[model samples]
Target: MTAFCATGAFAADYVPGELVVRIPPGGNVQAIHDAWGTQTLEQLSLRSYVVTPPAGVNVEDCDQWLDADSNVESADPNWITESPEAKSAIIIVAIGSSTTQYTDQGAFARIGLAEAHQYSTGQGVRIALLDTGIDPSHPVFQGKLIAGYDFVDDDADPSEIATGVDEDGDGLTDEGFGHGTMVAGVIAASVPDAEILPIRVLDDEGSGTLASLIRGIDYAVSRGAQIINMSVGLAFESEPLENAVSDAEDAGALLVAAAGNENTPTEIYPASFGQVLSVTALDSNDVKASFSSYNEEVDVAAPGDGIYSTYPGGTYARGSGTSFAAPFVTGAAALLFSAGTPGEPGDLAQSLTDSVVVVDSLAGNAPFAGNLGQGRLDVESALTGYLAEQATSVDGAFRPYGVQFFASPNPFRGATTIRLSTPAGTTMPHELEIYSLQGRRVRTIRSDSSDRGAWEWNGLDDRGRHVSAGVYLIRSNAGSLQSVGRLVHIR
Candidate 1:
């Protein structure tokens, strides 16, 4: 393996309990277009989300993730300033490049996921591609597409015509490039057995209004789509859209969103919402994508740089952005869901995070502690982990609130950090108190205004005094809400 350069980020080892976070993508529509040109989400994001996992996973392929000539280090300067923490090793896109006709790598190439093929390509699963409209006759969709409704015109034949068959008498086909067709190819194409529900939410401009996305979400839920891949996201997070996603989650559907390529920590929605799994892209190294979002909004990472996949007009092209990486995670999720793994969206979410293997350590991936949350998605590993965890029944009391917490560099030397979440717009003061193992209160820190979405603390007492090396507890209080986390201070 090639030597990896250090980015001062620690390697996020693949621990079974760790959550697979696909953070590190651009934040929203504007940012995504800023990363790429003016492209639509349903095409860029959903197509990747709906596709199937590659034939197999392997260490050698992971090695390619680190190669300088690999996807992560392409010509796109959007992330040139950002580097993967691991060495030449990296988390590569398991599937072939769209430039390669989005075809399956020969049997010899898919050695990474040797056992993955044993499972189905989610053939029977129905993934509704809500974008412009699909070319129903695409070779990949030979027999995989199902009858879909074009809400834009309320038409039965929802083709990507100059105007979609205005299903709702809106006299508009929605706005978008030929994205629906691309997205359908990713999902149903990869999993030939999987069926597609093509719903056009946008017009021909490759853009759609907020209302259109909400309606599209509702449409997918009604169609019994086990996996609804939403590759597009808005610049601003809307409460109405979030509520619709909440309903989708309640309806036993998996919604995959693309983390925008903003090159900062800004988060895009519905991917950044409380429960949604926001996916980011990685070159070979397991590092926080420079254009990817951070600050806990991201849940996992996948391959997105210089990604090759199916394009319009039966062509293939290579593109970069978090939009491409989302499908890998979505495909993995579909595979797991089809396998009948049991759990709530949260549990399934956790298992998915725990299932992937950190592939980037060679291409300077050691320092990205949480950049590529839970590393790259490993088909067999994720499936295996999901099945194993399924056997272990619920062990703890259920968490009533949707917030989550974490402590990085757990057994810390200089400083141990703790982060807390209490949703957005909470009208209450929160505090994080530190106590010694003996239950003695040593320090008290309150959640100031900076605790917008979540709060964090480096292992220290109220007086800015570092504590002794031992076990401690961080008690979180958000007005009426309370939670606790065990802390271990080292050195």
Candidate 2:
């Protein structure tokens, strides 16, 4: 058996004598195998399959031969990938304890998560987490997980388990254990209400093949995941992987990946793809971490050093790597979806880039300048700015609400006029209240007489303090009549 290497200086190490091929619809798999003298190994998806060439046929030759066949759409070697934090040690802080105490970690404050939560907790978004399996029973994931599968073991349960053997030759057994739990923990911490779909692509050793990763992507899309978080990456690009990413994007799912941990300009697969939101890591000082890969492909940065999150066995730990950094962006995307920011994946990606905190001028980051991406993530700014932009671009259609309730001059900088119309001959007292997107009541106005229906809000809360600029909801109740309308406030 001959080894296959990808086309690059830092080529990816792939399996020997194995090829992943895609067959067009209605193509005869048996005929292709008979013509090429190959054996079918596994069916990855409806149109993709894993096959082994006949004895003495090199992987490269088999790939070329399959590509030339009329039935085959594409063929490539099944490349290998690893978790970014596969070798890093995790410092376990607490076990079987309430997760509320650790919610105030520095990473949360650095990214303005507390402020961001005031707008949205990712109520209606589902994130597909593809990594080493997760601890399904972890306290942080209570009521946060949806149905998922384990491609490695070909099972329905995608739970993390410890294997005693050392897979990476690092003299430590199960170094990759708890990796998925940590990644899931980060997302749960950022968006407590967002549902997570845990797809186990990598094993406990943090090693997975391109075939499994592709299958995981297909599963996530089939399960209706809005965002896919991939903390694992290949050293070199593969056509099969890129095709999977394109399919996911076409299905309206946003892909977020770690930039890799080689600390070089070399691009990594999936992350290097233009459709993906490639994320790098930053320390507490707002500078790039020493081990994070950086280049023009990086889309954003997040706190990844000494980051604390959920661990296996219902515990919590602190670790660092670009793997953890990618989930922060994933969580932020969930927030945008929950806040009703309407658009495709590209629009959401633009919103995130436009709201980043430019760290080029920060100390210790002068060397990386444009290579570190837009900057460290600021979740609050991303949500508010996106909401405001959406508000201004619309025709102010009252599709979401009834015609009896509406706001004029939406996207107003200072204040806007709100009007509520009641049925004729109604004499019950009416009450109108303003609320943030997260459902926090901001102001309340009451009319004792039924003759009045218009009120001008000065963008102040009940305490008479000015609220920050963002989207707001106006709800009114008059006995049995209730109406809801949306408005935008700009600073």
Candidate 3:
């Protein structure tokens, strides 16, 4: 067996003398091994196996040889991927006060998370976070985590731990520790109600092989993950990894990945794949970060500079990289899924791309205009536009009201004007009712005067008390006149 190195500098791009291969469903494994002078090391799946070639056979040559065999479905070297975060980019800060409460960080406000939350908090959605694992016991993840597996250690507990040595020779031990926790924290801050499934693929040195990544993705899909967040990247493309991505997409899971932080136009695998939603990093001013990679493959940009999020030992830290930027897009996806956005993952991705706040016109991003993707993420716009589109698509064939009913500033904080448009000769008394999502009527506005065409809602209940922020349904029924509209109230 080839010895694997624990240090990043000594690690090879692909495992020597080892190949990941997929055989026909019922192919004879022994016969194929004998023909190729190779031995199966381990079976990854029913059709896939990690095999070692005979002593003198060159690994790359054997890979090509095996790939040409009709019995072999696919074969390739086991490529390695590393966590995209740079050690210097991270700044860990100890939580000074034990009573420090969890709140949305500045990045949240920059991405319009508060307004987005008024629409959907990602309730019932599951995000599979594939990284170096997480500090599961952290206060930030307290009721927000689900059962996860650690492919690195082949264990059930996917918690972050230090190796006590600087494997990367960067003078910092466990440099990648708490990386998963921070990524999870970003998702939690965006959608606190979303369930995070922490799958540990990368080791403490922030390095993992393509084999582990493929397995992790399969496990996430099998566990019913609605969204998968991969904050890791590899420079070279791997066929098996792409296959796994395709499988995940086919099973209805949306994959979001970080465009590597190399500050170059070079594409990174998984992120460069057409199926995945590639994310780039943006600074507080909406300018692209210095370390963030920009390419045509990037799907969207998000605030990643000095991102404050959860760390190990019940503390919070600030970090920066495309690694952190990817989660914001993941969180946005969860929010859309939770709000019952209809359609496949592709449709949802398009919706998000369409809703981006265009940053290309900004002076800071002028040089990289078309390479930065559609623009920076705007969660509020994504949700609001989706809701509006849904409202417009509703079956409006039957017009009982003989008028059009709508609201200006549909998602309002204090008040919104409900407008009713009718034909010049048409005048009818209407009673507008406001009900919570649970179908309980909260307030009623009666219009006995036919001349009135609009009414203002002060975001108050029928008892003249303020109602909690949430989605509300507005319906008007006067004899045969009936119309319904949706309203989002924010506090």
Best model number under lDDT: 2
Tens digit per residue, CA lDDT, model 2, 45-141? 7777888865786665555455457877667777777887763443334445556646878889988898888667887688999999899997778
Instruction: Please give the RMSD of candidate 2 to the true structure.
Output: 6.4
Error (Å) of candidate 2 at residue 82 is 0.6
Off by over 4 Å in 1: 1-101, 105-114, 161-176, 284-291, 359-371, 389-491
Clashes of each: 76, 0, 0
Residue 366 lDDT (model 2):
86
Candidate 2 local Cα displacement, residue 139, angstroms: 1.2
Superior candidate under TM-score, 1 versus 3:
3
lDDT for model 2 comes to 0.81
lDDT of 1 by residue, 1-491 (tens): 12121121212211111111111223233332343233332321221111111134221132232233221111110001111101112222333323344555221122133354344356446776766667776566667788887755667776765545543342444323445555565565345566788877655544444445666787788788877776666554444456567778988887777766666666667788876788887764445555555535767887666545554455554455566567666667766665443356676677678766664464555454555566666766666555443323221232465345566655455654556655666444356677764578988766556654344556567778766544566666566666666654543
Q: Candidate 1 has what TM-score?
A: 0.53
> What are the lDDT scores of the predictions, listed in order?
0.53, 0.81, 0.80
The superposed Cα distance between candidate 2 and the true structure at residue 127, in angstroms, equals 0.5
